[model samples]
Target chain A: MRRFLKLVAIEWKLTNREFITIFFTLIFPILMLLLFGTMYGNEASEFMGGYGSVDVSTPGYINMIIAVTGIMSLPLTLAQYRERKILKRFMATPTKPIEILLSQFIVNILLTILGLVLLIVVGKIVFDLHFFGNFFEAIFTFFIILLSIFSIGLLIAGVSKNAKMATAIAYIVYFPMLFLSGATMPLQMMPQSIVNISKALPMTYGVTLFKGIWLGDHLIDYPLEIIILFSITLVFGGLAVKFFKWE
Target chain B: MNVIEVKNLIKKYKNFTAVDHISLEVEEGCIFGMLGPNGAGKTTTIECIIGLKNRDGGEVNVLGIDPNVDYKKLYNLIGVQLQETSYQDKIKVYEICELFTSMYENPVDYHILLDRFGLHDKAKSYLSQLSGGQRQKIAIILALISNPKLVFLDELTTGLDPKSRREMWDYIKELKNEGRTVFMTTHYMEEAAYLCDKICIINDGKIIALDTVDGVIDLADIDQVISFETEEDIVQLIEKEIKGINKIEKENKKLKIYSKREDLLTDLVIFLKEKSIKYRKIDINRPGLEDAFIKLTEKTRKVE
Candidate 1:
């Protein structure tokens, strides 16, 4: 237990040392909230379909945090550790390798929650954002989206041959979803062809489902989104476990 | 008592036999060196004994424990530094020490270890700021921090400077003085001769020789080469007339005499004097661990 605590602390420190993770998770989402909130004035705007600009993108920004930790930081760190044989070195110790893995999950998941809370706080303070859905329902749906995206990151980490390849693949998957899934941009303003493209992306469903719940719609009304997110979680999570490599 | 015992151990990577039915035993409180060429399966055998790799056949016992089945407990007693392993680049030197020491059952104070390695002042420096030699030194220090009853080091001084290498040799000797069994593999012959009480040489996934430094040299049976600069071409004369000579090699006026006979040098002078062949700059080269290692790993069949 002492060993695990030390590993978690070390992993946490190491994660903090990464500038990109910090920017994407903590700084960039706030930038987005402030950027969009200033332009649209946080009023019930027709541009966002009766939701305030900050109100809508605020939840979407939580998905953005999920993308940063789940798709970018988590997979990249695992790949770098494996490529460098850091995992093998730790394995030779009395510490179980699983503890190292579990600590990463714990740290990334906690960071996602922290980022989500920060976004919500900024939205509430700066824009007086309205929350109409049940608070518990919002928390529950946030986790489902978090898991599905994180599992994709795990799958990416498992299949990549090296850290460099992992980065390239992660960029390919993440950048498109970042811009197209309405995580960063309002999908209502996109060309009809781009909106059609978002239909095929998994994050679009996540954002669409999460936005609906954030706008006072119940989770049961979005069965397709719930089923799709759970399917992604089950399939990608299983494949990640099957193909995971320690070295 | 034997700290490590292996019987007919075998490990294969796909169809290629990596560790082919090899066996050796390491007694307590001695530095046992494994010497072999690249791709000779030395690392594979170490991995199997350390429980990092599974054996295809045969049994391995480390400190009376089956490594493959009970490694978590066994690891508390043994320290290992794998060759290709590395530290996290963003982690500080002190943090790495703390993290590694936390995993052991009874770890020594790593601060003292860092001071011993001359890394005390670099505690705050990230791994990216340190040199390769410094990181390698940390690996060695981390291995000892476990206060292990047994230590396994693969290529312990491959990237170290001369000072650090000598320091490591002295420290490893100190480990043996403390009654810790040390098992290591290195390509440096002098390092092995200076550090190892017993040595094992494997080639082609099989044990070729396991003996002491001089014993391995003797086992390879390499003849000493006696060289002399001769004014005349007496190669045929030395070959035909000299007694106790195994073979003769000549390049121009330089003649090299290879023989296992102890009296070949004396007999060669007498023969050359009888023939009145003027010779100067005569020298005899005795074979050491390197010649034996090369011959044993490259040319010999399995001898164990």
Candidate 2:
């Protein structure tokens, strides 16, 4: 247990030392909230389908931050570690190789939670964002979304030959997820064809579920979204475990 | 007593064999060296003994534990430095030491280790900020931090500078003085000759020679080279008249004699005096580890 805690602390320091993880997980999300909140204003606007711009877009931004951290930042680091034989180095020690993976998960999960808290704090202070729905349910859904997204990152890390390949593959998925999933641009403003396309994206479902729950929508209406997220989590998580290479 | 024993150990990768049926033993508190060319399966053999690779046949015992079956139990008793050395690039040096120190049942005080390796002042520097030699020192430090009874160092000084290499050699000597068993692999013959109590030479996945440094040199049977600059063609005379010469070759203006017999030099001088051959310079060069390694490996290749 002491060894595990030490590993977790070291992993935390390593992750924070990198600029990309910090920017995407902490800085970028807060910047998005402030930038979009000022432009769309806090007042209830018909432009965002009868909800205030800050209120409707806030969940999208939050989910976006989660996706960036979970998919891009976390997996790239692991792939790089493998490329550099850091995993192999740990395997030779008394420390089991699995402990390194567990520490990475713990550190990234903590960072994701920190990102969420920062977004909420900034939103509440600057935009007067109000919570109307069940608070616990939102938090639970956030965790599920995190699990779903992070599993995909694990899969990427497992199959990628190196960090460069991981980054390229991550960006290919990251940009589309951000722009099309109502995370950056409102899904309401997109064309019917683009909206139909966004429905196929897992990130879109995550953002929709979070937005619906945060604005007091009934949880029972998004059963399909929950099922999709859980299914992706299982499939990706299984594959990641099956293919992960220490060397 | 032997700390490690292997019998007919075989490792295959698909249709190719990486380690053939080979056997060796490492005694306690000895610096055992595995010397081989690049593709000779030295790393693979080490990997199998450390439980990083599986053998297809035969048996291996390290410190009375079966590495494949009892690796978890053995982990605390052994340390390993792989051929590739790396850690998290942004992690500070001391943090890496502290992290590794926490992994063992009983660890050496890494602070003292850092100071011992001359890395005390660079404790707060990121891995990226350190030079190649410094990074290699950290890898060595991490392996020793566990304070294991046995340590495996693969290609320990491959990328180190001359000064760092000497420092690493001194550290290995210190480890031996502390009554620890050290197993290492290297292509550097001088390193093996200088540091190893027993040296094993492997070629094409099979060990061709295993003995003390001088014992291997003796086993190669090419004891010395007798070279003399002569105006007359004396290769034919030396080959016919010399009693113990193994080979005689003429290169440019010099006659080179290779033989296992220690009296070959005396025999050559008598032959030269009898033939009235005048030589400008004569020299006798004793075979070292490098010569023994090449001869043994060549003999193996030829037999195959």
Candidate 3:
């Protein structure tokens, strides 16, 4: 257990130094928040149903951080380690290869939590964001959202043989979801065709579930969203485990 | 006692057999070397012994445990440095050392090991910040950090400069001196001759020769070579006149003669005097591991 903890700590330190992880997870979401908050202040807009524009997007921003770390950084790191034969070296030691995989999982989770906390703190300070949802409900949202999105990342990492393939797939999965998922823009404003496309994305449901809970709705308010998120987690996470490559 | 024992070990990749019915033993407290040309299955054999690859047939016993069945237990007793393995860019020297050290129940202080390689000052440096040789030293340091009973070093000094290569040779010898058996694979024949107490040459997924330095030299059954430079065309005359001349090569006033004759030197000197031909830079060369390796590999090819 101590060795595993050390692996996680070292993994965390390494993840924190990655330029892409630092940029997207730690800085990019906050940048988007400040930009959107400045453009559309906390005034209650009719489109948001008596809530401010920044308030509605704050929860969506949390999911955005998830996509960055889970889909973009996580898969690429794992694939690169395999390509470099670093995973094989670790296998020759007494330590189990599963420790390396689990360490990455824990480090990414910690990064997501860090990004979420920063967004919440920044939201409260800069835009005075409202939080009508209970903390118990918020904690529940945390695990399921990460499970659904990070599993997609894990699946990509499992199949992609190297960093190059992971990058290609990550972009293919990340960009469309980032723009059309209503995570970046309100779904009410987008055209019907774009909204239809967004429905195919897992992040779209993540945004909806988060957006629902953020606006003082109960966790049970969105059964479809919960069911979709939980199912994505199970299906994709199972595939990731089945097909993951060590070399 | 043998620290490692292999019985008809075989590994195949698809239709190609990488290791075929190979068997050898590594005795405790000695440096053992495995040498071959590229694509000779050296790496594959090492991978199988370390449990990185599942054997297609046969058994591998390392420190008295089957590597494929109980590799975790075997790993605790052996350390390995692979030919091509890398770490992440952000990891510091001591940090990775600490991570690897934590896995073992008893580990030597890596700082002292790093100092032995003259890398103590670079302990906090990131892997990306170090040069190739520095990183190579770190790879070796990581291998020895656990102070295991047996160590496996693949291509140990491949990327090091000549000076560092010599240093690593001494360090590897020091490992044997400290009663740890060292199993290494290297392309450098001189390295094999210098450090290995027992040398095994494998080619085409088979053990071509396994013997001591002089023993392998004898296995080649090749002739000692005598070469000299002379302005005159004496190749024909030497072949015709010399009774023991097996073959002769002539190029640009240089004559190279191969023969098993021990008295060829005396015969050649007397013949030069009788022929009234002058020769300069005459030298006799004894066979070394490189020559034996080539001859043995050629012998295997011819038999097949």
Instruction: Write model 1 residue lDDT over A91-114, tens digit each, in one string.
Output: 887788778778888889988888
lDDT of each: 0.88, 0.88, 0.91
Of the candidates numbered 1 and 3, which has the greater DockQ value? 3
lDDT of 3 by residue, A83-132 (tens): 99988999998989888988998899999999999998998999998898
Docking class of 3: high
Which parts of model 2 are misplaced by more than 4 Å?
A: B231-241, B269-278
Order of the predicted models by DockQ, top scorer first:
3, 1, 2
Cα deviation of B25, candidate 1, in Å? 0.7
Query: What is candidate 2's lDDT per residue for B217-275, written digit by digit as tens?
Result: 99997758888898787677677776777777788998788788888777778877887
lDDT of 3 by residue, B1-304 (tens): 9999999999999999999999999999989999988999999999999899999999899998998899888888888899878898789999999998998888899989988989999999898899877888888888887788999999978977898789888888888998999999999999999999999999999998889988999989889999999999888888889898788988898889999998999999999999999999999998899999999988888898
lDDT, candidate 3, at B293? 92
How far in Å is the alpha carbon of B5 misplaced in model 3?
Answer: 0.3
Chain A TM-score of model 1 versus the true structure? 0.96
> What is the TM-score ranking, best to worst?
3, 2, 1
The candidate that wins on lDDT is 3
